[model samples]
Target: MGPIIGMSPDKKAETPGKQEERVGLRGVSGGPGTLPEAEYGAASPLATSLDRGSGGSEDEELTNLNWLHENLLQNFTLGGAQPSASPLFDIEGDPGGPLNASLSSSSQRDSLKSKPPLSFSLLIYMAIEQSPSKSLPVKDIYGWILQHFPYFSSAPTGWKNSVRHNLSLNKCFRKVERSLGKVNGKGSLWCVDPEYRPNLIQALKKQHLPAAHAFCTPPASPPRASSPPRHLFLQGCSLQESDIDAATAMMLLNSAPGHHHANPCDPDSPLDLSRPDSVLVSSDPKQDHNYSSMALQRCSSRSSSSSLSSLDEGGPSPGHTRSRTRPRRAGSEGFHSDEDSDLGDDRARPQPSQHRSSPLSSSVKRPVGKRARREVTAKPELDEELKEAAGSLLHLAGIRTSMELNKHSAKSKKLNRK
Candidate 1:
């Protein structure tokens, strides 16, 4: 009924232990007198849950409720129907007993009849609306989807991969790779780069969500640095003198996200930043290294981080590097996420293909203890031997009878080895 202990509206919603009676909204049964704040609005946990989702089949059910909640809250313009009537939000109140099932069903049926059946485009638009302001982790997107859309009680195998593919190639969804820019000189976070939201809205509206154009607008921000970043790929992994022109390579490989103000991806079109935005990371390395690794890979660029850190570069940038950057990327590569569709919007993933699990998953049986897992330096010979083995496997399995199957099996083996 009131704010849950330690829970703030702005921060992540932390669920308390399951209580015998969980508080939520119940459709009315009694007459007007049985209400408290019926004239105003009654905010509840269910309503907040409805506000966060990033799409996928898992999000369909709960997310739809959230959409309904929004619909109830927002009134049609003054020109429509009654000018001074209250929005649907004021209808919520506490019912002494269970809601009238028949009444609730009828109201839902009427609402459904009032509008066309739900469309994929509308689902996507709503999902985008519910996405986090900091851009959303592709994995978190699914949980959020499930949180808001209860239909995915059991996510389809490889459903995440499918969503990822479609998101990449789907004309309506904007997907891109981004880097974790430093935040306050101490850490990094996924920052929503300028124009990304506008571009995605434009793209979706042009295709699946034509009606969305009316609501598409971006909040203005202060001026950002005009100069382009030097490194091209992942900042820490492979910085070298040979990699100096990473900027050029990055320029070649990447483009402005919202240059067209439309969501078209051509060879000439700029790299989509949606995926990168999704992959942005918080600076707290203590949280989970996998988030960092995944976010970094989304950017997949070469940067001068190592060079600057080691003084390999003659000098560091004249400006401080601690400033907050932008949301970096979006990754749904795990079973909970969608596939890596570098080409198109979300497409159907074949099955639950086991990706190569992180080393921390298990090292020599159970490497994850209270201490952090160490990435051991490999011997050159061992590295060469592994490469040779991989090459041989590829050569022998060159034209596999089932490419997808082979990839899954290979990935499974790799994960097992880790």
Candidate 2:
């Protein structure tokens, strides 16, 4: 037993092949000093892919390993109770890896649970909190879930029934009967109890996500399309002060001179001096002519033919007829006719042949209604037939007058006899 020349005397010489086998065994079994490939792949997909490349440089491998160590150690806890084990290389370093796996699986199970299974009461409360009115009908809660939470948009029909069930059963949510006068009359309004808001918000946050995402701001109402002006009734037509001023100026210019006593251009008057004078003209010739004709008719009918003829023969000279006047009947000036007088006793005795003349015969002169020192205007011509008709009428008038006188005499005689 003297030392063999080719091998150390410690046990049987450790053969390279046996050592390789042992190393392979250690890799498969995840020995105390080494990590298994399956778990390495599971923990870091990047590391697994890197390891698959057989030709990677040493520096590149070392850099990648550093990155993995820094990033993973920062984010994940080793929870396996080993402080110095390499985060990327050690396997048994995690004694509690199985417990962690179980925890992760259980959490996965929890995540797999149906979207935090919104209890009916919780759903109603969330809906009311997010509603613009902070109150909603139970039916609206169903709709709100569909709108904000896409999970419910494609959900089965049972969710709405569940919601109604929860509202009915939950003491945390309140149902307010819509006032009778409300415009939306059919359904009761649903409200979350204010006291429960804190709990509801916490629960919602726990179930859904960050408060910001869970309670999203309602999309800004699409800016109401700017409405057209309400009082767009008129067309382009418009009135201006200048137009009114011009019209007023025309009116004042056309008004009578007497009406112009208050100077129209005065600040108090509507018209201004700037307006043209040509707008005003004298009275219409035709109107003056018609008025003169009317006056002639009135005067001619009351005057005797003798006075008319005198005027027609020679118009009065302005100087001699300085007091040119209209003719007036005596009775018209506060005098009554003898014909209107009661019979006197002297009427029984035969009186002088003083035939009672009509008050029209005794006429005194009065000034004409209007004084224009013009010659008498020529009368309108009468047709031959008209002259004849006028003569016949006068003759008939004389005969009627005589008959009336005779009747009066007979009546007087009869009275005398009585």
Native-to-model Cα distance after best TM-score fit, residue 48 in candidate 1, in Å: 18
lDDT tens digits, residue span 1-418, model 1 = 0111112211322222221111112322212211123211222311221132223332323222333432222211111122122111111222221222311332322222222122222234334333323233444334433333222213343545644554442323333323432222321222222222222322222221111111122114321222111111111111221221221112112123211222221212222222222112223222221222222222212222322211111111223121112112222221111112211232223322232234321122111221111111112333344334333433332223133234545765898899
TM-score of each: 0.25, 0.23
Residue-pair clashes, model 2: 0
TM-score of 1: 0.25
Alpha carbon deviation, residue 343, candidate 2 (Å): 99
Q: State how far residue 49 of model 1 sits from its true place (Å).
A: 23
How well does candidate 2 match the true structure in TM-score terms?
Answer: 0.23
Q: Looking at model 1, report the run of 10 residues with the lowest lDDT sum.
A: 227-236
Which number leads on TM-score? 1
lDDT of each: 0.25, 0.29
